[model samples]
Target: MRLNDCLTPAATAIRRKAASSRELRSNLRASWGDGVAFGGMVGFGETYLAAFVLAAGLGELTAGLVGSVPLIAGGVMQMVSPLLIRRLHSHKRWVVLCALVQAAVFAPLGYAAWQGSISAPAVLILATLYWASGLATGPAWNTWIGTLVPPGVRPRFFALRTRASQAAVFLAFLAGGITLQLAGGGPHLMTAYAALFAIAGGCRLVSAWYLYRHTEPSPMPASMRNISWRELLGQLRSGNGGRLLLYLVAVQAAVQVSGPYFTPFMFRKLELNYGEYVALIGVAYLAKVIALPWWGSMAHKVGAQRLLWIGGAGIAPVAAAWMVSGNLAWLLTVQVLSGVAWAAYELAFFLLFFEAIAPEERTSMLTLYNLINTAAWVAGALGGGAILFLTDASHAGYLIVFAASSFFRALALLLLARLPAIEAEGEEIGLRTLSVRPNAASLDAPVLPSLPSQAE
Candidate 1:
């Protein structure tokens, strides 16, 4: 029978009766395999490239800018994506096009860096292109992901995928670190960095190809009215969404303000060697891989709101731990805890945000979220740079600033307590209530109608 014909009731029933118990496992393996390939390439490539670039005499501010520029550019692009989606009329095509652009941009960046004499203006422009390319892919990719991964089992599936990705990331970091060591910390390092970027770009191309292979079910019909910035603002101002928006803004501001400087601080203040630094970071990523499943389960059980608090409460101590990290051991301990806490925060936040928004509004909602979060990151990065400049990069001063930022994050958690619980599949759920299945149609499922041109 044809593939479509095989999906009929009689065929399904027959398959169910004949199917071995291993079928489910086999399907899961396929999903996770794809996830791993995609995650490994993107995650490792991004981190390895950043570390390599920083080692090539990019000042701390410049290094931080490299990291933040993509976010800043991506955020700005996201603001207009909803409209673009309407005008373009094809999320998949747009995503593929963006991926191609990303590949094109990076090849030149690598070549320029390898040749040396890359001007600051050129670097900034390339960075902007790179960032924009990545950012443009977001809405389409995210929407496509929602279609591919069903809602009811998202937490479990994501947990499995994250573990696979994290494992790859761990190995990638190790290899990248070794490569940097072999290349040494000078012009040759730039060569290695450029090579890594080339490899990364290749991997991204493969990922894009894989994405194109997958089927995206039809989207919900577009709403009659097009979406506008005014409408978006109104949505934020009028409902429970408004309060959540405020809380998100607060959290983003707090985290981003101090987060970007952590690496530079370690390098400058602690004087960690390249291998040692990457290894330390590897420990954190490893911890995250180990802890993600548990956090995913926890988010499924307890509501994301409560998990948010746990994550927030945990951050203060982790930040505090940094102050006393005079050695690798202390830093490793802090890294483990920070990784676990961040996993919880990330999984919970995404789940919560997905649950809170209606299907029709997902793209716009994500766009807004990205925009706000990006702005916060930019503000924080700029602020951190200013602080460092003013203090002449004093370790003590940076530590104090980071500690304060952690406290501010905790305050945002306190604000989360007052936010309403999100209802999933007609049930009011808490962080501890993991058994409740979310709405399949709502969770990343592609059945929902798209917003009209005006709505977009």
Candidate 2:
């Protein structure tokens, strides 16, 4: 009887582990499906919010603000994710709800497109809803999925997932651009936008369905506990993580000074058709995609910190490079350089900063970080908007904002000086095992330093 009792417990454990392994495999596949569908939503829908604002006759300032400002509302709303998850007792449920809401947001956008006009207030409100729902999904989803994906596989798994996501983003974006281009300079342009947004909404719904398909092994991991301000503040203090966060926020602020206005600049001042605009961005997108493997290899050879320096230096002059020429060829050259630079910068931080956060605190830390990051983004965009407002959104005004962005980016590099290297969370990384890197489609947003790598 004693031997039988002992053997019984061991047998039960074996069965449990086998069950877990099966679920893990299932969850990983679901995540890939989710990635592809989510990428489709982002590509068809999220990338064009500002351009839509411009097409709606909202003027340049409004177009610029649409991309960065609503993010603050999203950030603030996501702060409640932990409490919501605690009450719901299921991260999966909360995430699915958020994703569904995000999908729904595009419906009204499509409607507004059909109408061919939406007030600035109405547009901002819809954007806030869109961003709020989208941002809320990040923290909870990160905490939930972290448990599903084993640490050993995280680097490679996320890399492959990122590749899938990027591929979808590129294809959907290209299709949307082509549709708009085909519409030509005519009344049907808004109709094309409507169709794009509707398709985007559907893609997100499919993404949510896949999220539902994921098996939540643990409804509440120990990591989901409340984090005290003392702990939060400790994470933000002037250590490696803190300095890195601050530097990243600064860089975001610098980047946004001109980032949000580029679309309008292309449409208005440059007089580029949708095809030319898409071509410019597509070149950059393709460049970034092709360069990722190379950047990953470089990171392995030189270490992530050095990689960060290389990327940082590469990006600083990019905005200013815009002032050197308005010629399409020159702009395309700049974008190729821009794509390669951003890939390195984004990958370095994914390795160094994201990996440094303890898994136990990642949920709360990222939730809070989202708020601060969004605020910085809004501040910089507002600064540039003010410049454009004062200068009447002229070509010279655009040039000024672009120059200032580069200047600030150069100044922000001061913080990166003397930074301590933090250990990465998993194994050595390359294209073979690197984390997420945003494609050019991500440029429409503030590109907050927080990893879409984790929450995305």
Candidate 3:
């Protein structure tokens, strides 16, 4: 009869539900669904933004810059995330908002396609928004999902989730390529792009829905901590981690030098149609997917440091390999090799870098790394663009940039050599970070801490 008795029942009813077996199972399904839908959005829509730029007559220069330059803005924009997350103290809410914003970015692109053209500036703006929204979600989603997925099963669960997501990415990307090919590769392809963007936007919305369905702990995990630049720099200066980070960033820079321009080269100089272009990209992506498990196993045996040497050596020549001959068969072979090289490089990066971070510091650390990494990316891209601009965007110009990329990649190996040996953990899987790249798929640097090592 007491008021305390009446209030106690209401309080208990409002309490957070225990993560019972059924709830955990449900969360797992929702998380996997989110991966598939997110991958669909990436493949169908995000992957083709540069292609869409070219089709819209935005100029090869613009198309070439599309992939790397905007990432600078996106990187800057994502820096706001850790701050906002600290203020709001809710990773889920921040992540979902970013996802929705990412979905909305497609609308303007689709509208431009409907209008039959878009300016170079407009393409840049839209691309910035897309990257901004997408990048912002990375740090938050990484933290949020760690709490949802139990560490005991984290390795197996994420491995399966990654495979499923990668499959979705490949299938959707292939479908988009086919659709664009069928829609007519020349002037009339705007409608096809528009439709792809629409579907891609819808996929992102569905991804957001599934993200919302995942259970957030009643009070969010207290692992979000601000890592000061001074402290981070001190940490970098004090260990082999700095050399490793330097090497990775340099590799990215070198890769971007040739990376963004490859698509425009395909569309213009090579005169490859949508189908052939898609085939090349798809081959690279499939090869990467297939090679990753092998790379993971190699890491366990030979250690990540050895894996880095293997990957770095292979990757150094990849961009330059394009100059060997532009024959489709040769190109496909190059793609397969490139994919394998990249898979090893990326896995080694995760094992060496992400494994070293404290969970509480991950969000901030990743934010800082994103900025440094993307700066290298933009610088490399701008360097490539300058060469193309100076050479008048000729076929020979593409080769020059490719050679330059290889040169820088080779230089990055010097840094790699200075890297101290890292003992590989015997974990079943490394941390997975989703990144969308043109003409290929591979893991990027981890934007989250390793799950198996999270503080209880």
Candidate 4:
């Protein structure tokens, strides 16, 4: 059956199920609200912290390194997180633990910065703690989400959540930028930024608390004794999994290579003031919010792989636009495009990832996926820095880096083309021959209706 035809009954079923379940409805609303709040506070803290680091006599390379190092460390650590989760047998508890750790770390980092001891090493250490928190939380978070959010409703639900989150991020950026502007880039400004971080940390704590309150249906453990490195490697070599891995790695490498430099490029090369920088990012995020729902719907309609291609194809020109123009107006325009592209890429990627794996394998697959993505980001940052150093920070250096990255992303898109499209969870209409695990009673209500026993 055609993909769209298969999806009709599933969509109808989901609407019916949603109308029937008051409890599920309430949980969905809460999750959406919490997600928005968490995203906003974090985005605010990140922008302010980054600007503060730049203002404190750190160079572009150092600032970029600050962001990239944690990712690298997290990537390396992520390989073990799944094993830890398996041993612990509790994803939710680990996520809360990570959040608590983050809160503890942030409070001190902010206090120290307020006391005027913000050094490169100090920044790196704080970042390490932060990223470690991320490493611990990410796989578990994804795993939990997989269970909580049903597949049929994910597109619409995520679209709403992302829209709200982006809106929050927009406000946070504006607030942070305004605070910095009022403080006049002096030692006092550090206190304001530090306070922002503290508040952001508190917000995360609240989010963690809310998450703990969420009821997750328990998952069946993998029958295997342990997930070995060899087993992971074997999975990576199998079927569409291998191809998807390569595509993800390549896309991550491409973006990360040039991604870390974006803020630095604005600060160093363009000499954007704090307010302008915040405004730029805020607008970009807003653009992303506006574009996300469309992308989500498109993914449901067409397929994720095609959307990936669109995202991959768009990056190069967007990067090249920055190289060519270097004007704020033009830069903002490109950032808007980049935001749309990123939204499409992210939404489609997550949906496709969930579709790709079995429920039993999700934790391991998610951990491995995050590990590779983090590793790619680190490598990209380091590689970009190396290229910049070699070329003595020339404009040509950035152009060369972005160009190469874009080319590789395009290559990844081409690779993605070879993989078969997975059916959307509810959308399987006439294919009764292929077997699927029905949702158990303990599982959330089936969002999509079962397909007809036989195709017409």
Choose the strongest candidate by TM-score: 3
Descending-lDDT candidate ranking: 3, 2, 4, 1
Which window of ten consecutive residues has the lowest lDDT sum in model 2?
A: 430-439
CA lDDT of every candidate: 0.60, 0.78, 0.80, 0.63
Global Cα lDDT for candidate 3: 0.80
**TM-score of every prediction relative to native:** 0.79, 0.89, 0.93, 0.80
Each candidate's number of clashing pairs is 24, 0, 0, 2
Model 1 agreement with the true structure over 1-456: per-residue lDDT tens digits: 678574979888777766633444454455455455545555445564445445655666666556564567877876666567667676777777776777676687678657754655566677677667776666666566555554555544554455565465557557767777787766687787777677767766775676566554544234322457688778777766777777767876676656666667667777777787776777776675566567756765776677867766776566656776568887777787777776666555665555556665766676677677777767766776777778777886778767777777777876787877764221111111000000000001111211111111
**Which segments of candidate 3 are over 4 A away from where they belong?**
1-19, 426-435, 438-456
Estimate candidate 4's alpha-carbon lDDT, on a 0 to 1 scale. 0.63
How much is the lDDT of residue 131 in candidate 3? 80
lDDT tens digits, residue span 84-147, model 2? 8879999999999999999999999999999898999999988888888988777677777777
Worst 10 residues of 3 by lDDT: 447-456
TM-score, cand. 1: 0.79
Model 3, residue 362: C-alpha shift (Å): 2.4
Model 4 lDDT, residue 417, Cα: 77
**Which 10 residues in a row give candidate 1 its minimum summed lDDT?**
433-442
- Which ranges in model 1 have alpha carbons more than 4 Å from their true place? 1-34, 145-159, 216-226, 420-456
